[model samples]
Target: MQPTHRSRRILRPVRIWFVYLSLCVALLLSYVPTGQVPGVPDWVALLLAFWCVRERQHVGMGAGFIFGVLVDIGYGAAMGQHALAYVLLAYAANAVSRRVLWFTPLQQSIQILPLLLGAQLVMVVVRMLAGAEFPGWGYFLSSVTGTLLWLPLHFVLLLPQYQPEERDNNRPI
Candidate 1:
């Protein structure tokens, strides 16, 4: 006898408040002193990318621009540097969200790596244009770290939306 596979259940829609709260947390994380350390992922960028992919309709360039501006203020970076990077990130994430949702988190991370890298590249270019010296290649380590973290972040973010697994014999779902 062949084993039959069960279809995956649809996840509950993500709440808008929860998404904004998570982004706020990400902002706080980025504000931590350790953020200057090599390989410390850009928490705001990572979280923003995740939401852009999962809830493009609800969270996109607006959230990106707002949080990006906040980040710029927090870092005292050139105004709109992070904002531009994040807006582009949101757009790219939304553009590919459908295809990304079709993959496992591991595979999704691989796809997201380039998007993260591109955002970082945009920041670097902005800094250079503002007459800042190159921060060096180590700066990109954040994207790598963020990519490595994608799997766990994926599970954590989705946890609240998962429905209970108990079978309800009384109801047809």
Candidate 2:
């Protein structure tokens, strides 16, 4: 059976709030220091990428750009460095998300690696362009860690979507 108009209306606001809360959490994580971690912890990037997968329309290029700027401000990095990287990375991820078969955990895991790496590469280039010297090859390690973290993260946020799917399946013809 088709969803009633009232159900659709109720879901709209709920979906909006979900996206908003995810963005807020992403921003907050970006600011938290990693302490002894050799570089930025993978959680922030992984969370951002996970949000992009789940809420592509809501967390597209513009949102990614804004988050990047916020990170730069919070981290006191060169202006626009993270912004440019994030926007480009979001665009790439958005494009890939549309075509990729997302049914399997392996597929999703495979898809996330390139998106995370591309974003990190963009930041590396931007830093170099801005005359910031290379920290080391170790900087890219965050992308690896981020990609590994994506699996558990994706499943957690995806629980709501699964409930809706199961409910639809249980409905009578």
Candidate 3:
């Protein structure tokens, strides 16, 4: 029993690492070209928001900053642009984490839309500041799509983690 318990404890960190691995996969998918496809949802943002609402303690501003920097470096954007945006998004999500977690997926999506939009707004502002031309209203489409994706992503990603506990009806009083 002691050996089994010790091994279980060792696996806990590996499980936590799997979460980060999934996030990295989402980040990679964000950059996948879709042959002129429009409104490609920001997988990183969606994942971060979901993790924030689902496991707030695990998805903090630090995670946001790290992932944001990874995104900036991977996507060839200005340094600290995505970093700042993601950190702000994480902070906003964390602020309302307690409240948001109680809401259904649809409600959660509605509540989180602002934060997702805010992240995009940050990107736009940064680009504009750098003398880049506007990318048009189409740029906002990702937020909408990302919001729509929340329901399925939330349910699906959390499905494996949901474990129903059994009640002991035969216990002696």
Candidate 4:
């Protein structure tokens, strides 16, 4: 007989302040100009999706909109481009949060690729409508990069919430 293993860890409740703080950090990271860099992930959108999935109640469309707008202002892109993209990303993430949580981080990243792509697609379409030329295929690489970062980012973000590994004899988990 094979010994059964626990696939999931019980996590402490996430602090609301930490969530916003991490988002702010991501916002700051995005402000750094990586000139001509291909496959540089959209840090704000990536972190927003992570929070949307992990803490759906605390982070959702409203947070998405605010950060998206900030990203727009920082990038000097057309207003509402990233905002619409992020709002849609949040909704999609929320809708799939439960299902995505059932999988490992690698699997979750695969599942989330579409959501990331959809968000990018929204921005592309909005930009085109605003008379901007197509940004070319390389623009989509950010979504792929974000997907690749998902596994590590998952462990890092959840590290604080992981319960102590030592088993206590007095208390039943």
Error of 1 at 162 (Å): 0.5
TM-score of 1: 0.90
Candidate 1 residue spans exceeding 4 A from truth: 1-7, 164-173
Model 2 C-alpha lDDT per residue in residues 63-151, reported as the tens digit of each score: 77888888889888889888887787777777777655344555677778888788788888888888988878888877877766666
Prediction RMSDs, each to the true structure: 3.0, 6.4, 8.4, 2.6
Report how far off residue 86 is in candidate 4 (Å): 0.4
lDDT by residue (tens digit), candidate 3, 66-163:
99999998888888888888999989999998999766678889998999999999988997898888888988888999999988887677655543
Q: Using TM-score as the measure, what is the rank order of every candidate, best first?
A: 4, 1, 3, 2
Point out the worst 10-residue segment of candidate 1 by lDDT.
1-10
**Positional deviation of 39 in candidate 2, in angstroms?**
6.1
Cα displacement (Å) at residue 34, model 2: 1.6
Give the alpha carbon lDDT tens digit for every residue of 1-173 in model 1.
Answer: 53344236567878889999999999998988884578999999999999999999999999999999999999999999999999999999999999998888889999999999999999999999999999989999999999999999998999888765665888554
Per-model TM values vs. the true structure: 0.90, 0.78, 0.83, 0.91
Which model, 3 or 4, shows the larger TM-score?
A: 4
Error of 2 at 98 (Å): 2.3
Which TM-score value belongs to model 4? 0.91
Taking the tens digit of each residue's C-alpha lDDT, what string does model 4 give over 46-111? 999999999999999999999999999999999999999999999999999999988778899999
**Per-candidate count of clashing residue pairs (backbone under 3 Å):** 0, 0, 0, 0
